[model samples]
Target: MIQMDLEQRQSSRFVRPFQVTNHEDETFSAAFEGADVNLTGLGFFIDDPDLFLPQQRLSLRIKNEQTDEVYCLEGVEVIHLRPDDSGKYLCGCHISHVTSNQLLAHHRLVMTDAETALVSMETSKLSEFNFMEDGSELSTDESDFQEASMALNLAVSQSESNQQEVARFVQSVESIFASTQSSDMKLQDLKEEFEDFKQYLGQMNESTIAFATLAKLLAHTPAEPQDKLAWKTLISDFETRFLSEEQQVAYDFMHQGLDADEALEIAQEYLKK
Candidate 1:
């Protein structure tokens, strides 16, 4: 366990008992024995050395446990009077104003025995429901069991869906690679027939059919470094052999149009393989 300073002084301040009632208007009043105190500048603090700011208006109600009387205080702002090295503050406040006999009635209600018993009973029941004993097993209600089962099934389904997507991507890459190989072989066969080869290259360039097919395939497959290197080499070789002076310009433009980041990603993926 982490150790902290245990020598620090700790004390509890017992204020005059009163009951409080909070209202929706971002205000709360404290009632005590038929008098209500309109409090302003109420806030909370901790023993840590960090500053705490209130997100909303501060208000509180104090109740007399012995008399069932309630007191309401409104419009209170908490001021950090003094802070220690550990960031703990000694806080104190004064009531800004008081109004109405309704506050006194509230104070009386809080100091009653019946009110004290009711509050104690509710607190005890809540503690019993929330508290866990040492070595005690967790208990699951029917709703909890159903939620667990649903979550398990959802996870299994998502796993299967991802697997299928990956398999489909792999298949697409293979198909495109096969088509490219076939086209390359055809180009090789027509090499001796210069005129025919030139014509074929022109058609290929005009259609951008092969590059388009490869691009689609690459889009589906995971981009690996090795795959990108191989692709670059293939394109370099094709450019060297079949690209005419004019076609080279078009090819350069098209290459530039492709996203460099995506190309690098494909290369990274190949490196992974």
Candidate 2:
């Protein structure tokens, strides 16, 4: 459970809800506390829960308690819904209209640190309980929890740092590609740079390995002549220069459309030579 202090401005006595009318129609309407307000979800919520009857529309009204202001939000989509033990349906809503001031007010309330900590603790307890049997040891040392938390923090920090490095590398490659004039040379340079970047990524965190692979592939696979040239030039200075003839042959065979097995065979042959 996340606890957040409700902003006074956003605290409403009631809220007016609106439903989608036409399957193709992008907008809908509903009555509010004697006034109607347009609403939109800003693309945040996507799922429509009621499966929204083909062409049928629904509306909801919510009132703000503090200001006694009533907002009629239209074109609301039911992103999520759950039925309680009492058979009351709770729904998560997204507004399709952007002009609703009530929607803006709702976002102002931010979660507090104490609330966040409680939620974290509850989640950890629940996870641990789910893994244990009835008689299993349930208590964990505070030190262990602290250590685990610190490790998670360190991992997140390392991931962010690696992302920043990759971003910098991509920017440099883009710059080079933009400045270069030769197409073939640019392609070669881009490939080399991508290979070097991949190697560097391998030496870093395993969590980011797939990301690095994707970035390298994207950096090298430009369909446009200008893009290819730009990438080639951008990567020229960063291109991984083969340290040995075997590595160079392997790189060449891979570029030549050789299968992985064939590339490996060529590399072995080059090494033997």
Top-lDDT candidate index: 2
Error of 2 at 91 (Å): 52
For residues 35-70, write the lDDT of model 1, one tens digit per residue: 212112222333442433433334556554455444
What CA RMSD would candidate 2 show? Answer: 22.9
How many pairs in model 2 have backbone atoms within 3 A of each other, for residues 3 or more apart or on separate chains, i.e. clashes?
A: 28
Stretches off by above 4 angstroms in model 2 are 1-139, 207-273
Cα lDDT tens digits for candidate 2, 93-190: 44433221332232211111344323322322111111112222222234334323333433344466668779978996897699756888778878
